[model samples]
Target: MSFPDFAKVIAALPSDDAEWGPRNTAPEGVPAILNNAPYAPYSKGDKLGRMADWTTDSSKDGRDGQRGGRQAYNRNFRDQQVYGAGASSLFSLQHAEDEATFSVVDNQRTSTKTRGGFGRGGGTVFRGGRGGRGGQVTARGGRGGAQGGRGGRGGRDDRYGGGRGGRGGRRFGWRDFDKPQRLRDASVNIKPDWKLLEEIDFSRLSKLNLETDEGEDVESYGSLYYYDKQYDKITPKGPEKRLQISERAYYNPTTSEDPVIQQLAERDEATIFATDQILSMLMCAPRSVNPWDILILRQGNKVFLDKREGAGFEFVSVNENAIDPPMDPTDGNKESINAPQALSLEATFINLNFAHQVVSESEERKFSFENENPFYNPSEETEPLASKGYKYRRFDLSVSEEEPVHIIVRTEVDAVIKSPVGKGDQFMTIKALNEFDDKAQGAGGAPNWRDKLVSQKGAVIATEMKNNSCKLARWATQAILAKADLMKIGFVSRANPKDAGKHVILGVSGYKPREFANQMNLNLANGWGIVRTIVDMCRNMSDGKYVLVKDPNKTVLRLYEVPFNTFDEDLEAREPVAEEDEE
Candidate 1:
């Protein structure tokens, strides 16, 4: 049904007046407020009707459900005519009367206040107290002995003359403290053309594919249904499917004829042997790996693995340079040239399964070298080469739990060439190991190794600031000064001449005045006076005659000493020379 027709049915329902109550049970046709209206003056004690008992058979035997019984009146039908006419008319009349009376009083009071006139009596003004008057007091003219003096011209009229004139009251200007005038300008009216605004077509705008003159392509519009269907259809036929198939075939070949198939078979056998070797080595001797020795090679370098006469092997190499000595006889001996010089190296070692194939076939063949002389002897050999240093010097490797490799390198100064390969220049002795051996424990002893693995996988060295090198230096300096009983003031020295003598200079035993000025560029930029100032401050405080001035606002303490007049000339007379030469 239409909405209006449904609403009309709702409006026609019978109201509360149709029920039998005091108002409805009033005498039907009686006039003159008579007929002893029985329902009038209604009270709770009045008997209306007998209560029904649901436990009796009248309700349960289906007799109550028949026609012309109580069920007839209980039908879902309402008589609107019996109650609608009087109830609506009486409410409307009373509401109209209340509105009419309220409007008259409200209008009258609004008119009175808006006119700015007070009712009947007017305002009044009152005058205040008068001005003060001055009066003279005179004692009785003399005594009887001085009667003549008492009558002397009525005491020459010594009474005060009159009161001073009252000052006029202040009068204020009417314009003072007046509110600014308000201009009567019209408000701006901006009427929008609502018809020009387009109605939003959400369905068309949100469509995944829009049909233009171009051909069909992948739709980029954000439609969940379209994306889901497109992904479902494309995924299985994509590149990932090919990758999975290839990986499975490479790991588990179907036939031994395939090269990959043979490799897989060999790899499985090799893995078993390698595991046994690692276990045997670990059990052979209780050994510890040094973390510092496990160095990460820098970019553009190579590692060479050298085989010893026995099964024990070591890795080393000269990276990005010639291993043999230079041809020039005057260039110095080989040991002198390679005297424990710091060189960055890079290297990588991977299992055959993970290693990339070498492009050159000849190089690959060279890499596959092997010796099978199991009963080989070494005593029947030519002259043995003198032991100059470690056969293998540097090693770089990455070790994991699944494939652990032990690495150890001698960092001590004597580990390099022990004998002088050169006459004048003795071969520098690179130490093999030092006393701090316990501090060289590797990753197994590291407390944060697990955290480092999760958060910073390949970061071997902690950041510079994390090492606290500078902080430790400062702390050590302060400790030395404290132990020496010297005043410790935490002040940053300035590089300017004007800031000299403002901060204390410590550890100035071998500090040259010229070097300080040159390093700071104070001679050409600021002046040589900064050097003089620093020297004077240092000399005066050398005898421990200085006062500590504490800053009230901060924790810093400033040490001050008396200035010396001859300090400037003394620094100026010094000659310019290299600081290292002076040392």
Candidate 2:
């Protein structure tokens, strides 16, 4: 018997158990790494054919030991033959010239069974069976054959068929896991420092002065002599015109209280002097020397006083034999500077009546004083020699005055500098006198020269000791606290904490469905996983979660937790209601 035909044997073999085998031991076709091959012009189709040959060789080699020689040969031959024939047939079907004839014949056949002149099975596949005796061919039947199977019915031009169903979509779920809790968002602290305050200069102040002079009108006396020297001399010249002297001080009132003054009094640094009381003492005190001066100090600077004694005092005498002097004499001996001898007279107390007259009659009068003997209780009983017609009285000298002074006082205390950051020079100045006028017509129009002197002295002492011991403690404390606060807030390099959200997960091979589910559950437990995984992934990657679901046409990813109450309502409406069973 002849060996079974190879094509028939291969076709009859079960496809499930068949295997191609044993490729050539030597390299089958072209070596994967080609060497020294001639360059040949190639068409797109030729390149494709070469690629197919290479794939076939590779596949054969890969299955070498697993299949028999006959099986391999059959498989290769059948694949080439069947695939090639099928491809040619499909191409012919698409481009067949007989299409018009088929279409004409198909259209010509019609049935009156349907309103459209076509039966419901018009597009259905038909099968033919073997003819009966006489070898006549069988006619095509409408019913499908057992093995031929039914062909899909052609669809109406306008009607689209339902698409395949999609996979069940993924949803967010929660699972329990331990996690750390977060506390405060942030905290910071600040401390105080005095560097800026120290930089201010406090000693400088504007100085003001007023002065006046009195001289005899020699020309007028000469004119009186020309009219009648004897008569002018004899006639009591309108009570020798006296030179009236007065002094006043003025200042603006403000609400700012000197902190230094307050501290000084609190610490018992000095005594307070009331305005009225100081005025009374200054007015009553007798002037033993020419140009007696007084000074007031605020903090460490000098302040001008309201009034003081003048450069000299004069007494007028009436002389009947005195000859009047000539006006504008131009003689070398005419100019004379004969120093008057100091007078030593009996004790002369202030004329109370005269003082009262001065206060009541003067329009620009300032402080007034009663002429009671200011030195009534002198330290010694024996009176000293009189000088310049005034008794010498010993005055009590004490820095602290019992009464509060109208003048403001300040002290050197530690002040916290607010703006600049580093150590620097700082200063402050205090106003000494409340007021000084240039046109003042009084005993000593100038501010009390002694006040300026006292200020200079005090300022010198205070500036020498720049350190304010009292402020040091508080300043140090504040600075330390501020540094600590800065450290706590990570202002310092070493104190800062590691930056958050820097860690990332890695090493995953493929998308694991179960692992994704677990991660979703974990996220839910942590209040971050309520969103659907596919939807979340899509949101992270592109736009919609529908794109990620297996079937975009059917599956949907919804924001279930959004308007959670609405979701609950929908769930409640869809749920089945319970009914009582009949007994």
Candidate 3:
């Protein structure tokens, strides 16, 4: 609480106005609430999970009996003492002094009874606490775990219900915090009973699986699963892998949200995360170019990122600015603090050496999940919003090729960095190549092209090229080669053609190819096509700083501004989104 809040609290007390909402309305600012609190022992009933949210003065009972009595929030320094069913209040007008000890009287029934469990079928085992309506009410967190136990004398045959008249707690609206329901797909409560799932034989579900089994008699296990789909009896190999990661994914560089550049305008923290919301960056430290060397490499006009292979990239925590390598000579160990001038690992190339999600002869993705493939177009002019990726990662791999996915790029798991020279570049760390070295016998054309006598070590480049079949990877690779054609990538903010503005992006992700291409007279497709050209240009620009701006005139997200970084003004590229047609 600040000084201003304290002053406000003082001024809003009783002296403020004698009659305000029957002297019980909560103070205007914040409320003091007590949630999930146990009721007084042997009280009328057990009520928890929201204590002191209400206060009653035995006040007037309005229409509908107002639950019978007028209940008000007692924020004006008032306290009430409640006793069990057998005990009386004994009555007192003065407020209690002990702030540590606070209690409330509940009108709910605080009793317990036995119950029986049911089998898989609809038939019931027995009735009581665990059975039907008269069954036991499950108790949870509270004094002595308030789910069971008895009240009053000698355990009577009584069934308690949820709160009702005289069943609520005393004094409310005071809480350390409130537990709001989460909006994500997973439940905060209710773990999926996989064990029970295993016990059930999918083959035995023939009757249930039969198409004719539709009707009221059909077996339905509430939240056990979703709409009728062939269950994968084999069980998912890695169900946990699909669990949603809370961190934000990298955004296309054309968007301003990439954590790497967003903060460029504000803080100077060298080891900053590309995600503004996350404090930690997945560190691939120790002489990996600058702090963020993970490039979104491209060749020609193609991108070369293999999601599965990217997983091989290491993710650690390190200070980008404080890297210090060992000064000792003849240190053969390469994983040093500061990489040797010759030792380098670039994110410029794509890695693709990971196991793919295996599919059975019949198993395959079939759902038309939204833009799951950025390239696949809609069947009709419009598409169903059902499986769209815009929502969450719920793509049914069986029904759609899209799986709940996240890529972790590890040098071992993904692709490796390609040095200036194709194959011999790996050995170039110790020696530089001369301009005219025709006599020098190097990686002889083929990558790692070794004479088979050396155990075919030369197959590394061939193997990489073989596995690098993804079109995006190819495009990115091409884009890397096309660097000389571009002076700088012009992130088009507006496309009026008259005063179109663009954020000139300096190089990122290690793409230092030839000169920049001028867009002045180069006519392109749509404004978005222009942006797409640039998004692929910047490697890992992952932050949702820019969103598709709907023109309202059309459904296309084609109008968005390139956010400016005043501090990085000097880093702007020399080229602009030129109005000239392709010369």
Q: Which candidate is the best by TM-score?
A: 3
Write the residue-wise lDDT of candidate 3 on 198-261 in tens digits. Answer: 1112122221210111011101110000111111221212121221112212112221233323
Q: Model 1, 118-230: lDDT tens per residue?
A: 11121110111111111122222211111111111121101111111212111112232552332211111112321111121223212222111211111111000000111
Q: TM-score for each prediction?
A: 0.12, 0.12, 0.17
Q: What would the per-residue lDDT of candidate 2 be over residues 152-173, giving only the tens digit for each residue?
A: 2211110111111111111111
What does candidate 1 score on TM?
A: 0.12
After TM-score superposition, what is the CA distance of residue 16 in candidate 2 from its true location, in Å?
99
Backbone clash pairs for candidate 1 read: 412-430, 412-431, 412-432, 413-429, 413-430, 413-431, 414-430, 414-431, 415-430
Each candidate: RMSD: 43.7, 49.9, 29.7
Off by over 4 Å in 2: 1-583
Superposed Cα deviation of residue 119, candidate 3 (Å): 22
In candidate 3, stretches whose alpha carbon ends up further than 4 angstroms from where it belongs are 1-92, 95-294, 297-583
Evaluate all candidate structures by whole-model CA lDDT and list the values in order: 0.20, 0.19, 0.21
